[model samples]
Target: MTEKDFVPKKYSEIIEQGTVSWQAPSNIALVKYWGKKEHQIPANPSVSFTLKNCRTITKLDFSKKDGQEDFEFEVFFEGNKKEDFKPKIRTFFERIVQYSPFLKDYQFEIHSENTFPHSSGIASSASGMSALALCVMSLEKKLNPEMSEDFFRKKASFLARLGSGSACRSIEGDLVVWGKHKEIKDSSDLFGVNYADEVHDNFKNFQDTILLVDKGRKEVSSSVGHNLMHGHSFAEARFAQANDNLAKLKPIFAEGDLTKFIEIVESEALTLHSMMMSSRPYFMLMKPNTLEIIIKIWGFRKQTGLPVSFTLDAGANVHVLYPEKDKVKIFEFIKNELVAYCENGHYICDSVGSGAKQLSEEN
Candidate 1:
C-alpha cells in the first residue's frame, strides 16, 4: 500500500503506547464563577478564556510493575517541589479513578508543573486540572481507541470538578460556560461549549489584563468564602442579585455591546464581593494597594470615558478588560498609577484563545 493509503491498525501502535502528556493554559473569568451550592459547583454559570503564557504541563506514564497497580503523583509550583500539594494530588487521582473505573488497575506516574506563581490569582486551578483531565483522557484513548473525544472531554471535566470547581470550564474553548444547567450532579449535564457558539457573540473585542498587586496566598478559599456567604444574613439578597445579574448579562453579552457588558460585569463583581463582606466574620481580599490601583483605573476611565471595566476573583489581583486595540493606552495608565502601590505587581495581557487540544502523540 502507498504511504497515503497506509494506516495503523492498532491503537497501541498509533498512540506509541507509552507516556501521555498534555498542557493547558490558565484562564481568568470575564464572568466569575463564585460560590458553589453542591461541592463548590458555582452559583451562576461563568465564562473564561484559555490564557497563553500561564499554563500547566502534565505528563502521565502507565506501566505495570510487579503485577500491581502503583500510582505516583508530584506537583511543582513555579519550578519548586510542593510537598503540601500532595493531599490535593492524591484526591484528584482518586476522583479520576472513581469516574473512569477502567483506570483503577493501572500503574501510573503523573507529574505536573505550572508556569506562573502559584498564589498570583492566575486561576492555577483552571490550567492545572484542565491539563490533568486532558492527560487522563489521552490515556483512556490509548486504552480504548473506540472512545470518542467528546465522551472523554465530558467525563474528564466531571472528574476534574472533584478536584476544583473552575477546572470544568478549562476543558473547553476560549470562552467556556459552566454550571448553566441546574442538574450539575448529573455528570451528563456538566459539559462545556466553545466560546464561538454564539453564546457570547456580543462582546467579541474583549481582552483581559491581570495586575498582580499581591502574590501572597489567599486567606479564604473559595469553599470557605462560599460557606461564609451561605450563612451570612444577606445570603438571600446576594443570591437574588446573582440571579438578576446572570439574566441581564446574558442578553448584554449576546448583543456584543461593550458598554452594557462593562456595566453589568463591574456591578456583578461588586455585588458578589459585598456578600463576602457581609459574612459574620467580615474580611476583604483587596489590599490598600489593590484598592489604589482600582481607584486609579476608575479615575482614568472617568477622564477618558472609556468603556473599560475591572473585576476580581476571590483574590487580590485585578482583571481589567477592554478592547484589544486600546490595550496600549490602558497598559500605560495602569503601569504609571499602580507602580507606587504595588512593588512586586506585574501585568499579564491575554486574549481569548482556542481550548484544550492534543499537543503530541504522547498527549
Candidate 2:
C-alpha cells in the first residue's frame, strides 16, 4: 500500500520523524472467560491479572511505498514465518483504520516478538494482541495528539477483541473485567473495566501458581468447546452452575477469604471440564498425569489443611491458587510430586499485578 493511501495527514507528519514502539504483558484469568456470546464476547464477565514476566514488544514503521491502496502487513512468531496470522493482522489494521480512516492507505511494516514460548499455551495471544493494539494506538497518538487515554484503551481493546477473544482482558493492568455488559451491534454493549472497581475492597491479596505440567497445545479451542457446550445435555445446568459460582464467589473474593476463594474456583473449573466430558462424543483434556496431579493436590490439602486450588484452561497445565502465606508449603509439595511429570516443567509464582505497559523504547 502506498503511504498516500494509508497514511493520513496526522500519521504522515509522524512518519516523517521515525518509528514508534510499544509493549504489553500477558494475563491469566482468575475467573476464566470460557464461552462467547457475540463476536466471542464472554458469556459471564471474568476477571484476570496481567502477568509481569511474560510479555510482547511490537514495533511499527511507516514509509512511502509504490502501488498499494490499503495497508500490507506481515507477522512473525519467534522469527518464523506465520502466514496464518494474516487474518488477525488484517482485522487489527482494519479496526485501527475504522477509528482513524485517513491512515487506511499506507503499507504497515510490523514486527513483534514474544518473551516466552510461542506454543507453550500460556496466553500468548493475550500478550501478542494487546501489544499490537498498544503499538497501533501509540502510533495514532504520535500522529494525532488529540486522542484521550480512555478513548485509546477502550478503542484499542475493541480492536484487540477482533483479533482474539482473550485479548480484551489484557488491555488493562492489575485486574480487568471483560463482558460485564450485554452485547449490541452498534459496539456499545462490549467493554472492559478494572476489576478493582467492580469487586469489593478486601480482595487484593490473591495469588496463583501456574503449574506448567505440560506445554502441549489444546485439543479443543474455546470456540469449539463453547459450541459443544451449547448442544450438550447438561448445558443449561452448567450455565446455571457458572452463574451460581459467580454469585457465591463475589462476596468471598471481596472478603479476601482464601478458603472460600479456593472452594469456588476449584468447583467452577471442574464444572467447566465436566461439561466438556458431558458433550456428545465425550472429549477430555486431562491426561493420566493430570489426574495424578489433581489427586496429589487434594491429598496435600487434606494433609496440610491449607487452602490451595487448581484450575485448568483448555490445555493440560494446572494453575494453582493459594495465599501468599502458604507459598513455602505449596512449593515444597509441587517440587516433590509434580515436577517429575513435566519435561523440564517450570512453575511461575505470581500475585495479581497490572496489565501491559511500555517497558522501554530502546528494545
Best by TM-score: 1
lDDT (tens digit, per residue) of candidate 1 on 180-233: 633222222254555443445435546777788777778877778877756678
* Candidate 2, position 201, lDDT: 41
Q: Name the TM-score of candidate 2.
A: 0.84
- The 10-residue segment of model 2 with minimum total lDDT is 180-189
Per-prediction CA RMSD (Å) = 6.4, 5.1
lDDT of 1: 0.66
- Candidate 1 clash total? 1
Off by over 4 Å in 2: 1-17, 64-68, 91-97, 100-103, 181-189, 197-205, 360-363
lDDT of 2 by residue, 1-363 (tens): 111232344443434324556677777666666656655666666656666667788776655455647777666666666788888688666655755553454456667787766666576777788778777767677667776788677766766776676787777777676755322112222545665434444445456667666777777776688777556787666656655665566567566676777777777777777877888767888777777788888998998898777877666777776666777887788778877765477766666667767644421
- List the pairs of residues colliding in candidate 1: 202-256
